[model samples]
Target: MCDMGQWKQSQHFFEHLLNDSNNNNEDLAKVECSLGEVLQWTGEWSEARKYYNRAYDRMMNIKPTRIKDLAYILFNIGEILYLEGKYEEARDYYERALAMQKETYSS
Candidate 1:
């Protein structure tokens, strides 16, 4: 759905999935991330960041946390900031993501 550029449809599908699931943190996080991407592509940077933040918060509560997932979200956020002309902030996020990625893969 998202790959085809149907953002609204993708958002609706993700929202439905989120609503239908119960205590499914993984699904929740995925939906939030997908929705955030849609919002970002639509130029709703603030709203997108809100969803990204929610996804990150949810990820924090999951067991055996995946650093790559967190870093991916951070990278997306960095891209959004870069697009919005917040170069310094974007650099911060990019560096954080790069550090996490290196930490995860270095071992």
Candidate 2:
């Protein structure tokens, strides 16, 4: 549903999942992050930021072991920051995401 360019449906699905009262469901967090990416693509930065922040908060607490997922999210954040014209902050995020990708591949 999310990867098919169906941004509105993806957003709705993720919003439902996030508010489902299931705090331990990591899948919800992942979807929320993806939804944020879709929102970003649609130029809805403020809404995107909310979902991204939610996902970030959840991911921080969970500390996902998948470096690829982490790196992707970081890259998305960097991209969003870049789009928002926060060059320095975006660079920092991009650097971090790139470092993570490098580390993952090197290992």
Candidate 3:
């Protein structure tokens, strides 16, 4: 749905998945991240940040923390900040995500 540019449908699907009782923390985190991406695509910066933060929090609570996924969320959050004109904060997040990616890929 997202690949097809169906933002509304993608948002609906992710929201439905988010509310499902079967979702574990990791699943919820991924869904939240996806939903945030949908919101970001629609230019809903604040809402996107909220969902990204939720996803980041959930991802952090899990075991063996997913570095790549965390980096992705961070990068996306940075993009939102950039869009909102928070250049310094956006740069900070982008640097953080880049550092993580470098560390992950280098080793």
Q: CA lDDT, every prediction?
A: 0.90, 0.79, 0.96
Clashes of each: 0, 0, 0
Per-residue C-alpha lDDT of model 1 across residues 52-95, encoded as one tens digit per residue: 99999998888888789999999999999999999999999999
Report model 2's TM-score to 2 decimal places: 0.82
**Candidate 3 lDDT over residue span 71-93, tens digit each:** 99999999999998999999999
State every prediction's TM-score relative to the real structure: 0.93, 0.82, 0.96
Backbone steric clashes in candidate 1, count? 0
Q: After superposition, how far is residue 37 of candidate 2 from its true place, in Å?
A: 1.4
lDDT of 1: 0.90
Cα shift from native, residue 63, model 2 (Å): 5.3
Question: Candidate 3: misplaced stretches above 4 Å?
Answer: none
* Candidate 2: 10-residue stretch with minimal lDDT: 57-66
Q: Which candidate leads in lDDT?
A: 3
| Model 2 lDDT, full chain set | 0.79
Judge candidate 2 at residue 79 and give its lDDT.
83
